[model samples]
Target: MKGLILAAGRGSRLLPISATRPKHTLPVGGVPIIMRAVQALREAGIDDIGIVTSASSEAALRDVTLGSGHLTFIRQAEALGTGDATLCARTFLEGQPTLLYLGDNLFGDSLRPVMDALDGADAVIGVKRVPNPQAYGVAVVEGGLLRRLVEKPRTPESDLAACGVFAFQPRVLDDVADLPPSTRGEIEFPEALTAILARGGRVRALEFTGFWSDAGTPRDLLDTNAYFLAELRPRVQGQVVNSQVTGTVVVEPGAVVENCTLTGPVWIGPHARVSGSAVGPFVSIGAHSHVSGASIRDSLVDAFTRVQSPERALSRAVVGRHALIGPPGEEGLQLVVGDRSVVRL
Candidate 1:
């Protein structure tokens, strides 16, 4: 089975981070978010993947998936809604049964069950009960079939929120093509789902009770990191020196830790360096990064970053790649720096 990953949206909520890299490229547990999706598809026996991306993200997307033969890229010229992004991959789809995943959504369960159910249904949508369905594309399911879908209704009739994972027969492309642009000037997938329902197409809902998260905003990313860490429990594997650690922590191979205090629930990626610092409780240091003479708690430091003395970063922050923090005389406080950014203080 082929898979379609919709990664075209410009993640405005993520701001500076998304400005430099696509949301899919954001690191979660030291791995790019989209790579996680790719692994999930591969694990489900679907190696052939098609990614629909906006032109702005083409280069970064290619760089991330380098040497992956089963992957293909299609450019969506506009940030049209989910329906249009899926339509961008229509040429490569070639009438095969396809699995569609939102680039931002992460699921804990294997996708095989939904894939199996797709054989008998026109479309299979992953749904989960959420406390606030009114904020999502809510689904009403009856007798194991999806009865209706209301897109962000003010008063939702159900708690079954669409989780943005869908398996659809190729014929669903027709519905996508026929959909007119929504008031927001983007082709909406919920509209296509509605069209399918009106045509007597059976839409199956897989009520997943496992872990799932969509990292659309900064807070969401932090929450997802904590959620996955509950299960991942990454352990430090490389040499350590002069560091104090407490609780659960994972340091990947070749990582260096010295003169640092790492509280539990922290992950230091491969080849990363943690020196003369107080880290963790909730922290993820990306590969090849260095942190010294600093205090970081509840933060994510991306690849190749350097955090020197007189630096203190607190709750819910992301420091991007190749960044330099703390020049000669700088104040210590909370900071979120983008890729290649430099801060004097």
Candidate 2:
């Protein structure tokens, strides 16, 4: 089996943060989100992978995913839909059963079961019960068999939403290629699955009740960061001078944490500098960022960002790369600053 990751979404919902880089290139627990997906695919024993990316994100995605595997990058001319994105990689699929993972969906569960489930099945759709089923592709299952797939139905039949991961047989590519634009005017993957079901294709529903996030918005990013950080193992490869570091903290090499109080589940990326700060409890400071005289918690400061002298604490903040936040703030700040932005509070 092969792996196909569709990373071509424009990520407009994550704007400003995604202004400079694709959200897939953004870090979660000091690793790029796309790379995490790659790891999951690799763990399933699939080495040959095809990544479909947009024109704007292709270069950046290549930079982060370099040397990861036998990766073939395909460019989707437009940000159509997941089905269109998959169609862009038809050459890579090459008549092999494929594992299709949405680039932005972050699933913390094992994917080997999904791989194992492809036996004698035309497709396996991963489904999880979500409160907002109408917002996602809804899966209607009866007797553990997928009866139909609907793309954001007006009235959802079930709470089981398609979780953006699927195992497809070799002929599924032909099915996806023959798909037409949905009412949303884009080629949707769910519509193709629904078509497959209409033709009596063997489709099974796999229920996943673990942590899964599309990571499409700021809140999703922070939540995904914290969820992954909870599994962190303490490894201090950098200088921790005169600091009170506790819990599951990882200070990467070339980083310096001086005179700071770092609580658990905090990640200080390589070459990041933190001084006179109280960082922790689910915070990820990106590579080469500098945080000084600030108290930050439950936030993500992207690579090359600077947080200086914020009198009040920062919580639930998602600052993008090369951002300059501060001088000081009168009260606690909750920000969603974009890349290369300068915010003086």
Candidate 3:
């Protein structure tokens, strides 16, 4: 089987940060969101991976997946729906079974169930029982089969929201060709599944109860980072001087934390420095980033960023790569901020 991840959508909800960077480009526990999904697909023994990305995000996506060989990148020329993104990989798919995983979807555990379920069903969808199914694409199951599927229904018929991971046979490509634009003006993928049912094709549903995040918004990005960081093993390979590093924290080589008290479930990337700061519980400090004299928790500081705030309490903050969060200078001051960056006092 092959693996295809759809990452063509413009994450409008995660604006300011995602304005330039794709939502899946955001890091979760030092690993980019798309990289984590790719890793999961690799662990499932599906190495021939095809990523469906927008023309704009193709470069950023490729930069993160350098070492991952056997990857085929297909750029969707337009901002199409998930259905179009998946169909764009038809040449690479070649009628073989393909596991379709949404780029932003994250799971706390392994994706072994996806491969196992595809053996019996013509199509297998990953479903999650959520509190508010109206906000998600939900699957209405009858017996063991998916009877119906709805995306963001006003009154959901079921609480089993489709978690954006599915195992699809080559028949879905035919279904896609048979599809027309929905009322919302996009070639919705759910329409393809509906076509499958109309053709008497069997589609089963697999329920997953693990930690999941679509990472559609900035808040979701922060929470998902914290969730993944909690699973890391404790290892401090860096310099910790006059710092109390407790719990399951990973201080990678070349990182230095001095005169700080760090709590568990955190990861400090290589060459990162945190001095005279209070950071903890759920945080990830990216490579070469510096955080000093600040109180940060449940936040992610990306690579090459510098944050210096003596009494600022930063929680649930996502500092993007190469950002500067310190005070501005006057004599020879220079500010080189990226496009669509956010700056707030």
Candidate 4:
């Protein structure tokens, strides 16, 4: 089966953090979000991958995902919905079974089982139990099979939110192409799956119990970063001078952590410098970024960003690349600054 990733979404929920860069290019644990989806598909033995991207984000997405695999980039002309995005890549699929994964969603579960389930079924949807099913496309399972797929239902019949991964047969593409726009005026993937069920096609619902996040907001980015960081093995490839690093932390080559207290489950990217700071317990400093005299926790600092906030505590912040963040006032700063932006509080 081939793999198709939908990375063309504008990431409106991510807001200013996604203002300059594609949300899929944003890093979680020093790796781009789209790269993680690529890895997941690769691990499932799908080498021929196709990434559907918008014209504006194609360059950025290509830069981060270059040489990742046998990847083909298909540009979606308009900001269509997920089903429309998949239909745009029909030529790449070439009538073969395709595994469609949303680029922004991150799940810790393996796709091997989902692929295996597709052996007997026409489609298999990866689902996770979420609190707010109204905000997501949900699956209704009856007798261990997916009975219906609903998008943002007012009264959700099931808590199983469709978690952005689906194994579809070759004929599913025709069904997607035939689907009309939903009430929201977009051709949603859920409607496509429901159409498959209506045609007597079997669709299995595979529930994922592991960590899963859409990563479409600053808070979700921090939470997803922390989840991935928690699985990080302790490795120090950089220089640590007068620093106390506890727990699991990965200091990549060329990164220097000096006079800092890293409280575990942290990732310091290559060439990043952290000095005189208290970082960690879920933090990822991007490559070539510099953070000095700052007390940061549960934050993601993008590459090439300069944060010089002495005696200030920054938490739950997502700082973009090439930006400058100054020291904050008494209340401290929890910001979502975009690329090349300056925040001097």
Per-residue lDDT for 215-332 in model 4, tens only? 9877788889988988888999999999998899999999999999999889999999999899988989999999998999888888998989655688887888897777555686
Q: Per-residue CA lDDT of candidate 2, range 155-199, in tens?
A: 999999999899999888788888888777788876777778889
Off by over 4 Å in 2: 328-345
- Go through the candidates in order and give the C-alpha RMSD of each one to the true structure: 3.1, 2.9, 2.7, 2.9
Question: Model 3, range 200-243, lDDT digits (tens) per residue?
Answer: 88898988888988988878888888888988988989999998
* Residue-level lDDT for 88 in candidate 3: 86
State, as a TM-score between 0 and 1, how close model 4 is to the true structure. Answer: 0.93
Positional deviation of residue 220's Cα in model 4 after best superposition, in angstroms? 0.9
Clashing residue pairs in candidate 3 (N, C-alpha, C atoms within 3 angstroms) = none
Q: Best candidate, lDDT-wise?
A: 2
Clashes of 2: 0
State the local distance difference test value for candidate 3: 0.85
Summed backbone clashes in each candidate are: 6, 0, 0, 0
Please report, as a residue range, the 10-residue window in candidate 3 with the lowest summed lDDT. 326-335
For model 2, what is the C-alpha lDDT against the true structure?
0.89
Query: Measured by TM-score, how close is model 1 to the native structure?
Result: 0.91
* Candidates ranked by TM-score: 2, 4, 3, 1
Clashing pairs in 1: 234-250, 235-250, 235-251, 236-250, 236-251, 330-345
TM-score of each: 0.91, 0.94, 0.93, 0.93
